[model samples]
Target: MNLAEEIQKRRTFGIISHPDAGKTTLTEKLLLFGGAIKTAGAVKSNKIDRHATSDFMEIEKQRGISVATSVMGFNYKDVKINLLDTPGHQDFAEDTYRTLTAVDSVVMVIDCVKGVEIQTEKLMEVCRMRNTPVMVFINKLDREGQDPYDLLDEIEEKLNIQVHPMSWPIGMGKSFQGVYSLYEKKLLLFQASKQKLDDTDTISIENVNDPILNDLLGQSSAAKLREDVELVDGVYSDLDLNAYKNGEVAPVFFGSAVNNFGVRELLDCFINIAPPPLDRETELRQINPTENKFSGFVFKIHANMDPKHRNRIAFVRVCAGIFQRGQNYHHVRLDKNFRFSNATAFMAQSKEIIDEAFPGDIVGLYDTGNLKIGDTLSEGEKGMYKGIPSFSPEIFREVINMDAMKTKQLEKGLMQLMDEGVAQLFTYEMGSRKVVGTVGALQFEVIQHRLKHEYNATCRFAPINLYKACWISSENKKKMDEFVDSKYRHIAQDKDGKRVFMAETKAWLQMVQDNFPEINYHFTSEF
Candidate 1:
């Protein structure tokens, strides 16, 4: 297909939610509909079934929570869908934040019982910042939960976005029967047989009062469905596409992701109405998706996806034009042109080589060591896009290598992990000792675990007793040098060789700021 046609055929989005909201289950069900997987694997299931496709990391499988974002693409109904499944745990917010920069829209999943949550609110804030359109899925309808009306009120009040219910449930919990479609004006009866999840048995009725509907849902459920449909029609009579595209409103669908109920309808409506890949903002100007020049930016970098190969991959979201295999694109950050022959697309842990990809496509390029997150690659115009913002670490720890003989292994593992943006690495006294900083304490556990399991390097972690980390820089180079040199013991260097200072208390940070009035103390390293 031509570039313009190809771009039009692509729909890219990320799945986000609070932990245990069934976000992963919803993702696998969508993938199953797209023919990406034959059978969906249940998350946190016993050893009998394989783990969820998106939770490819061993740590994630073991913990029953996603820690990193997984990109999976598949073709359905003549449309290419790029699904970015992000970690729901607040501890991994950094990974999810970075993944948000790569997608055109988002699917916000909410557990019916939980309503809006902390992580969900935070994620919605980020989406609003970018004006990214969102679709809401009220999952776990099979289980007893809050009233649908109450959940809608919670979403509207907390998220500050109006909701349009595209599908109204017949009954919730064990009394759950099916859903009445608001858009299609039909009643859908659901009976799940996940062993054959790929094949959906559709029972659509035109009349809600039909005897078949009463027989299927029983008289009480059928009457409740009638009442709900009437209320939905009177209140949410119109779905404003413009409001949706502007992120002012979200179209809501209800379902139980595990049983594969009401999922297909959601997917169909999503691809039909979800906005296409939108233009990206850059320093120079807005880059439209149809532009002929090939340009893209790196959002994420992962290491050791293939355990045996130990290869590093840079995930790039194509912003404009077409990307061809073996073509040279200018690396704006390095100010050099590099050609990569090992460009491929992701399917969870698996990858497939492609000859060309379009604007909305995210292609993985092999990186020996040159690529960094937010690096720009373009064939014609060379300019860097806005970089991903890093969050300040909430906890600090000094990493001690148990095996001094494996110093190289320790350094290698730490460097790779840092490059993945998993955590911030710093050193005090000019690299005499190494410390790691993370947004959550669980990250320290993850780092130590990965080092042991993946690198064959065991290490001990000691608390650094630091409250905050600051990146110190100033226009007055001489004064900055004097300040850092005088406090060399307290000063440190980050992975990029940037000067950092570890503050033991809020007073210490304020004192340093007071001393170096001209010096800028930045909490995060901007991409």
Candidate 2:
């Protein structure tokens, strides 16, 4: 197959949801159906052992949670699908933000029972801010959970997004037989199967007629489907389900990903209904490399696992024009230029050498040293894009240096960890140097375990708030100065014989406004 043609017809989306809402399982099945992998790997089993294929980190495998974003691609119906599997945990929400910056759309996965949660809301907000289209998956319906209808209602009420059911599960929980695609108005059933990441022998899609599905197709249900379809059709012509005589939105295929059920139908939905990247709106943002010229954003950076290569890989999204291999691209922030010798398109961990990539494609460039998150690659004069948002570490804990052994090694390891997009590191110089590891509190145990296993560094965590302080200029600074007696404001001389105003926040604001009336004062938060 012509991979570039398929990529031209591709739809790039991120798989996102609350932790353990079956986001990863959905990702595995999509990859399997698309033929990127043969057998879908279970998150619990860690069976395929495709290290760094997606969540290619030791900490992810050991803790059974995704700590960073995983990029993978596959093909369905000759159209390419590039999917980003992001960490669903609130602690690693920053990873999701970076992943969202490059994608055209989102697949918001929700647990049938848990419905909407904190991370789900956060992810939704990011999507909304970007105006990215969304397709929701109420996963795990086969599990013993709440009614799918009730869950749908919750989604509509909470998410403030239209809940258009493309597929309806035949059963709930363990009994989930299959799904009815409302759009195609087809009933898809799955058969038992298993294969490896490279093997392609699992699940197949077939048309089926079950009384449950038939009943859903009856007059009463048909009427409801019509109402829903009209509501959807009236709002967006893109969803013209009226084309389906069955008056359905689309077909919903069901099966247990853990059991390898209903995988094929889901794949069919992606090929049949998901919007291609070219079909989606192009994101217009300020580029550091100049608007009249070409530039791209580095979505991720990774070190090749192969010891021989031992080089850093920079994953970039070309926002405009074509980027060629063996050419120098100005690194705007580094104030330097570097040449990319080998550029290749990626399928998970696999690489296919490619000469060039254009806007809307994600490709990897090799041997770019000192690449960090949010770095822009451009041709022509260097400028800064509105920088990618920095993730604020929510929880803070000091890393106590024990044995004073390998403290330098510990610092070096921490610096390397920062590159992995895992957690932020802060160092404090006490009698002994204290390293503070900041992450979502849920990640503390995992961090400790990794430190013991990966770094072989013994450390203790001290509780801290990571508090930030903010103040109003008028109330705090202006008032303090107005209230301070003039005698206390007598000119204070510094060693340089220069006068300095040793004033509180309130006094500083008052002095600035009184002395410099034309200047406007602004309040800032101190972290």
Candidate 3:
């Protein structure tokens, strides 16, 4: 295929949800439809040792929660779909925010029992800021949950977006039978499988009032669904592709990810309606995907996927053009040109070598500890992408190596973790001691766990009496020097040698801002 044709055939999106909302299960079912995995593995299973494909970390397997973002690509119905599975837990919102920058749309999974939770609200706000389209998947229909109409109303009210029901469930809970498709005017009934994953089922009826549907679902359910269909057709808003693409309306779907019901219908509609590779804003201008030359940006860097080899992989989202292996590209941040001889694509933890990739494709590049988050790479020009922001850490702790003799090892581990964007690492001027800052308390545990398990460097964490971290910059060089020397507040420097202040309370933060009105004390930094 030509460059334009190849770019047009790609669809990129992210999967986001609150914890335990069946996000991972929905991801597995979508992969099954794409033929990426023959048998889907349950996220937390006692009978089978297998875990979900997206949760690849040892810690994730043990905790049965996703802590990092994963990128997986597959071909479904003649279209290349790049699916990014982000952490559902609130602690990993920083990582999820970064992953959102690389995709054109998002599939938000909400539990039917719990409408919209805290993490879902935060994630949806991020998408709203980016004007990224969202598709809602109301999962867990097999189990008892909220009424479908009430759930849809909650989504519309809480998310502040118009909801258009693309597919509606016939009967929920133990009485659940199948889904009634609104667009196709068909009834899809499913049979539960006794195997590890649900087997694909194919039973379609032309009319919602069919006798077979009444037989599959109870007569009352069939009549109720028919009445609901008429109500939706008369009152509910129709599917508006333009409104969806503009992030004003979301097309909602009802399904049971475990039973694999309504999954294929969602996938088929997603690929057809989801937007393709769009323009990305850079410092220079908006870079269109149809551009001939290759351009991309690094949104995430993960270290120690293989603990034995201690490998570092930089995930780059191809934005503008075609990327070919063994081709040199300008590293805009490093101000140097380098070639990636081993450009690989990911299937969760496993990856394979690929010859070329197009726009909206995320390829992993091997790194020897040089790449930083938000670094831009281009084959044509030297310009940086904009709007990748760094969030302020909500917690602070002092890190100490358990063994003083392994200080170098500790430093190495800390450097690698910092480069991976795990958290913000800061150092004071008086001593070699370093402090770690994170947006959530769970990150401190992850940092210590990784240090001991992957690096074999055990460490102790000491909670610090800090409330806020701020980045300080000013045009007056003398004022900046004086502010750095002031002992009124604790001071530190980030990895890039930028000065930062750690305040102990809201009063202290306000005092600093009030005192230094000329200086910029930013809570978050933009790259």
Candidate 4:
């Protein structure tokens, strides 16, 4: 297909919000309304198992929150929509950042009552930094103690973005109705009763084609829709929509994603207004070792289900030319080349075999053989794609020593943990003895559980004082110069002649680097 044609065929967007803001509910409703799943499933109960597409982790189910990014794809109006459902908790914020690297836009979901919280602010900042277009979905209109207008104002004031309402809630709290599409200027009312697709739910398309639906269909009659279209046109008047038929304005659609209220309309709006991959600004970056060679970046990774081939699956975003299976591609981080024996397109968890993939498409390859996060796969020259920022473990604890017989198993499990990118492994050795470092106290519990379950190695843990080194500028040039040259960590005296040692460090620095890599290493050692 032509680039423009392909652009019109797919939509890539992510769902983000603060914790308990109804993001997963919204995701399920989207799947149900888009016909990806037959039933709407609740995260609380893994009812259908299929509806839990985004929350695939056991910890997420136990904790009742998303811990890692879950990817799902569905079709609306012949246009494929790839949805990246991100974690809302502050601890897993790194997963959100990594997910955003592969998406073109975001559908920011917010709880009406909470408005914007710390996580929301952090996510908005990332979106702004990336210049990714955003659409806000003020959710939980059905819950008590919510004010849509107030939330809208908060979003505008805090985020400093245009708060053009594409859809407005008809009522708030218990009296919540459906939504009025501000752009379409029409009200979307959902059936009060649950809709089950059988003989009754099926309606003839010809019979449903009435004047009201016609009005909803036409751009001119839909006042709010027309206004939105016009506003976008005024902003890009010189740019003709027909010239770039796939291009569209950022649209916000409101609905109770939990009750499946106004969900169909929202999906329709997404297919109608969201820009296709081809129309988006082509992100130019190095893909391989050869400066001119074609390469792609893997955005998501999965483990295959089959026992024989239950290896790592790399989901690649083709940034440049075509990539074929069984070809050797350089892994930028590992500094080695691995061959993708089988490359395929992923439909949720299902894999579709494909020989090659082009730019603007997401494909999965199995047995990437030591491939890692931020590793670029290219044919000839060594070029690097920006790596996904590492996520910091918010909590930390120390692992107690295990028996000698189980030490090897513990090390193997640590390697597995590192491979998953869920936690970091820090090993300190003192005369053949080793100590492992983790993010927080709770992580030690998880590590112990994993050991018991996976390796049958039981262990205990203790809370240790998370130590750090700090320095004060006493301005003692002689001491500072001496400290800089020594291999052993030396005390630096600044101009004020005060000694600076490792005593001032804290665990907070690790968390800062984990959450905010954009500024982590920007300064030199002297600074």
Best by TM-score: 3
Mind giving the per-residue lDDT tens digits that candidate 4 earns over 411-458?
A: 666555455555554332213222333333445555566567665576
Kindly give the number of clashing pairs for every candidate. Answer: 0, 27, 0, 34
List the candidate 3 regions with Cα displacement exceeding 4 Å: 47-49, 193-201
User: What is the alpha-carbon lDDT for the whole of candidate 3?
Assistant: 0.87
**In candidate 4, where is summed lDDT lowest over 10 consecutive residues?**
518-527
Runs off by more than 4 Å, candidate 1: 198-201, 207-212
At residue 88, give the lDDT of candidate 4: 85
**How does model 4 fare in lDDT?**
0.59
- Against the unseen true structure, what C-alpha lDDT does each candidate score? 0.88, 0.60, 0.87, 0.59
Off by over 4 Å in 4: 46-51, 192-250, 278-294, 300-310, 334-336, 391-395, 401-403, 429-451, 454-461, 467-527
Better of 2 and 4 by TM-score: 4
Error of 3 at 404 (Å): 1.0
Q: For residues 21-76, could you state the per-residue lDDT of candidate 3 as single tens digits?
A: 99998898899889898888878975445799898888888888999999999999
TM-score: model 1 vs. ground truth: 0.96
Give candidate 4's root-mean-square deviation (CA, Å). Answer: 8.1
